[model samples]
Target chain A: MSPVLVVLDLMGIFVFAISGALVAVRKELDVFGVLVLAGTTGLGGGFLRDVLIGATPPAALEDWRYLLVPVVAGLVTFWYHPTVGRLERQVGVLDAFGLALFCVVGALKSVEYGLGPLPAALMGMVSAIGGGMVRDLLAGRVPAVFRSELYATPALAGAAIAVLLDRLDQPYAVSALLGASVCLAWRLLAMWRHWQAPMPSGPASV
Target chain B: MSPVLVVLDLMGIFVFAISGALVAVRKELDVFGVLVLAGTTGLGGGFLRDVLIGATPPAALEDWRYLLVPVVAGLVTFWYHPTVGRLERQVGVLDAFGLALFCVVGALKSVEYGLGPLPAALMGMVSAIGGGMVRDLLAGRVPAVFRSELYATPALAGAAIAVLLDRLDQPYAVSALLGASVCLAWRLLAMWRHWQAPMPSGPASV
Candidate 1:
């Protein structure tokens, strides 16, 4: 990855790690649990994508910066949990940016690794949400992504746009910016407007 | 892998997949969800261990048999969920056998990939529990191994024993049998005797 993309990736990890740490704190987990949760939430999606795509020793494991970001985020959140808790709404906005970035990055990486566009886009969606799924698993709750309004859908749309543009030989920056902007705008709109996916209709099957 | 080992692996996958399918049924997930949970539970542990050890395109992905076992198991369980649910206790015994086998298989594979003895053993424990961990994650619950009596402990111990014997140049059968037997005996005993890991002590810090 280019230096700029790497920096953005690290920033995304930092924000996601903070969100995970805050969740751990609210759950009253110990420091170890806090650190573990933070690291997984920040890096787990990338790890899953890398492993499935035959990239061994995932980038998070290879890069010291990646390791350090989550640890620092975890420690900071652990120490100032009350302050962090109060800033969750703000943190969530940053999280959407992270999601936007990850959707593109994961999709691009998958394409580079020879995945088809659709599969690459699916991987991108997985990259955006996989961490929170793992985090919810460890925290003993349902993954919010499954229930959240317009979360993964925006990521998928963004990834599809990115991969499609890339396939058409568009400049890298053009594809990335457009994809991320669409995802970010859609997510922010969903949050602001309280848009939710419809519940199962006539749900008496059980 | 040897033919014998491959068959054993398939059997393990079949049992684990059924367990996962049963969980999905109880959770009232649709058939598609049941199949996915089955596949993940049957294969997730090996995927985790293989990916961490730099094994690419995990065996399950490359082999049709590996994929078939889980799908068949899932469908069978889905169609006869009531009977399967009634067999939960007996099925758990089969699950222990699967865990025992996985502990040995995963450790040996990790060692082949050049991990240290301890890490290989840790990988073995992961192989035994990872599928269930993922199954519970998707099912929206805490991993049973984390809270169950003497579950992961036996797997880890069994793995340690296997790796240690292999390091000492013991015969493959000797190491595999000893490791699997020890794990199976310990786990069954724990279940029968109601052994439990101690909960955290002292007043609530929160």
Candidate 2:
């Protein structure tokens, strides 16, 4: 992996871990439970991506850094959660950056595995969202991606752009940067503008 | 799969799906949600087991029987949940049986992947509990297996016994039967006696 990609991967893992820890604090889970949540959130996306792409053991399971980063994030959140939780918007921004980065990384990995563009793009979206989906399932809520938030759409767009650039014979690095930029820009814009997908109306029938 | 094993696999799948659908009904979930829960619960274990073992597309993803069994079980529960729920203890008994069968199946698959005995045993236990764990997470409850339940322990023991028998050149059919029987017996006994591992006491100073 490129140094840039590695850095981006680490950032994504760190932010996801923090997000999980924040949820753990909200739920008042024990330290072990909090650690499990944080570690799995950090690793879950990449794990699924690796499995789909035939990369056994995945980078997270192979490298101690992937595991250590999440543990540190979880502990930090546990100790200073009151202050950290106050900066929820900042955390969301960080998460958005991480999500964008993961989208690009996932697409790159898929292409590395020689998967088709469409499947690679879908893998990127899945990689960006899978861990969060697992986190939300554990937390007993509908996943954020499934809701009206601009989560999966941005990731999908990012991956699609990356795959398109690859098809156009752009360098991998260039495609990755473009993909990440698009996702980050779109997600940030969505958050700032409170953009949401419209749900079907006519509720309260039950 | 052997004919006997195939039949047992379907039996386990059916029962697990029934348990999942029953839980959904108890939660008063809509029909679609019930089916989703049932499908996820019935297939979740094998899905994870395959992914970990590098079996692409996962058995649950490729096999229509795996998909159809859960849907059928969900429909059945949806139509007669009041009656099924009344037989909660009976459901528990069936769940134990399913758990045991999955444990052996998971172990066998892992060994086929060339994993060591310990890892194979872990895979078996994970496979047995994985679906229910995901189901409970979605339902917003702590997974039953992670707690004091004897669920994982029996699966592990059974898997170990199977591996030992295999090493001793026992016939595949005999080993599988013995393994499944041991797990079933242990699990059923545990439930009957309300057996559980002791919980950790007091707050952690760390």
Candidate 3:
């Protein structure tokens, strides 16, 4: 793997882990619990992706950086909560960036393995959401993406765009950059406008 | 799949869901949480295995029985706690049987995909433990297998035997039976004797 790509991947992992630690703090979790949440949220998606792709030892287990990145992210968030707490939305923005980056990476990896476009796109979605799903489950809440938030929609859109760009014979770098931009923009717009999916009226008016 | 295998698999799913629901109840989770935990514990392993093997839709989403099994299991446990609570050890026994049987099944499926014995055995272990790992993570507790428990050891042994037997040209039926027997016996023994892997201690203590 290119050093640049590896660095980007690690950055994505760090952002995801910090986001998870923030959620745990919001939920009033202990330090150990926060670490567990952060670790799982950072590595869980990539672990699932690797396992499904038949990558041996799984990336989460093989890479020392994968282990340390999340722990450090968790520690930083835990120690500087008062200051970091003010940047909750900024954290969401960073997480959105990670989600976009990881989704493109997952889709490209799937295509490299000769999977069909549909399967590749699904893998992208899985990689984006799997970690958060695990984090939510551990935190005893419904997954944020499964709720009114437009979390997964952005990832799906970005993946589809990346795959389409690739099908058009675009350069890998260009496709990845555009895909990340798509995800980040969509997520930011949704957050700024308070966009949410419609919820059913309560109990049929009793 | 054989009819006998089908029935046994369904039974295993039911029992595993019950096990998950029991844990949720102990944690005082709500009804939705209970269902989510039970469903994940019952189906997560097989789902991970199938997805890795490129099986579409996965078993949990394909068959109505797979979905219903966990729901019913959870509801039954929720409604009849005193009755179900008294048989916790018996549940462990059933869970061990399920682990053994599923390990063989998972290995056979991996082999059918033309993977090596090593990967096939690993898949079997994944199919056996993925659900419980998800459950423990959701319950905000370390997974039992991650600790000193002999839980994962039995599954590993069963999977290795199944793969080895298959490599030796044994019939699937015979290999599966032998593998399941080894797993069940080993797990039951571990449970009965409170067997565990040795934990690390300080240098002086060791």
Candidate 4:
């Protein structure tokens, strides 16, 4: 990986981990639970994508740095939850950045592994959202992504753009930057405007 | 896989999928949600174990039958939920059988992948319970395993027995049968006697 990509990846993990740890703290889970949630939220999406795409042992399992980031985040959240909770808006912005980076990277990685563009885009959305879903589940709540937010659609769009650029022989950096920008812009706008995904149009049949 | 093993694996998937579909029905989720939940519950455990053990592209994705079982289960439950829900008692019994089969198979597979006995046993328990955990999360509820019942412990015991027997050079059939029997008996006993796992003793710190 390029140095820039590595930095971005680590940043994404850090922000995602912080979000997870914050949830754990709010739920009054023990320190162990906080750490577990942190680790899962930071790496769970990539793990799910890798497993589905036949990339075994996940990058998080192979690298000590990947594991360390979440532990640090968890400890910080556990120690200073009140302050962390107060800074949630900042964290949400960072989380959008992370989501943007992960979606593009995940799509590119899937393409590199020989998946078709459609599946690659799907994998990208999974990579961005899977961790948060796992975190919510572990915390005994419905995943927020499933209920609200225009989160996954943007990730999928970003991934699709990246895949299309790659298909047209765009440089890796160019494709990544553009794709990430699309996701980041969309996510930030959604947050600023308080946009929500449409719920089921009618009452669900019992 | 041998014919018998294939049959047992399919049976386990079928029962697990049924349980997931029932949950989706109860939640009033749409057909899409029901199908997704069924697929996740039927295959989630094996996917978790396989990823941890570095087995990628999970067996379910590779095998059409594995994918078909859950879809069929979901459709059946969606169409005939009243009848299916009424059969909850029988489904619970079948779920115990699935648990037994999954624990043994998961342990053996982990051993094949070169995990240590302890990790192998842990994987077995994961294989038996992981699907249900995913199912509950997707259905917007706390996982039953974490809150109540003697679920994971029995799976661990069964997996441990299988691993130990394998280490002792026992025949595969012998190890599998004995291990599965232990899990099935313990699970049924737990159900009959209304056994529960111990909860945290003191009030959790805020």
The C-alpha local distance difference test score for the whole of candidate 3 amounts to 0.81
Which rank order by TM-score, best down to worst?
2, 4, 1, 3
How do the residues B66-115 of candidate 3 rate in per-residue lDDT, one tens digit apiece? 89989999999989977898999899889999899888898888788766
Regions more than 4 Å wrong, model 2: A2-11, A24-40, A47-90, A114-119, A146-157, A185-206, B1-18, B24-43, B51-87, B90-101, B114-126, B133-206
Output the number of the lDDT-best candidate: 4
True contacts kept of each: 0.25, 0.14, 0.06, 0.25
Clash pairs of candidate 2? none
Residue B167 shift from truth in candidate 4, angstroms: 2.7
Task: Encode model 1's per-residue lDDT on B79-121: one tens digit a residue.
Answer: 7777777888888899889999999989988998999999999
| Alpha-carbon RMSD to native, per candidate | 6.7, 6.3, 8.6, 6.4
Model 3 residue A69 lDDT? 89
Better of 1 and 4 by lDDT: 4
Residue-wise C-alpha lDDT for candidate 4, range B1-206, written one tens digit per residue: 89999999999999999899888777765565566678889999998888778787677755668878898998888787887888898999999999999999999999999999999999999999999998986877778998767989999999999999999999989999999999999999999998999878899999
Q: Scored by CA lDDT, what does every candidate get?
A: 0.87, 0.81, 0.81, 0.88
What is the TM-score (0 to 1) of candidate 3? 0.58
The CAPRI category of model 4 is incorrect
The Cα error of candidate 4 at residue B163, in Å, is 2.4
Show the lowest summed lDDT stretch of 10 residues, model 4 chain A: A197-206
Top of the candidates by DockQ: 4
Count of clashing residue pairs in every prediction: 0, 0, 0, 0
Clashing pairs in 1: none
How well does candidate 1 score on lDDT at residue B116?
Answer: 96
Q: Give per-residue lDDT, candidate 1, residue B94.
A: 91
TM-score of model 2 (CA atoms) = 0.64
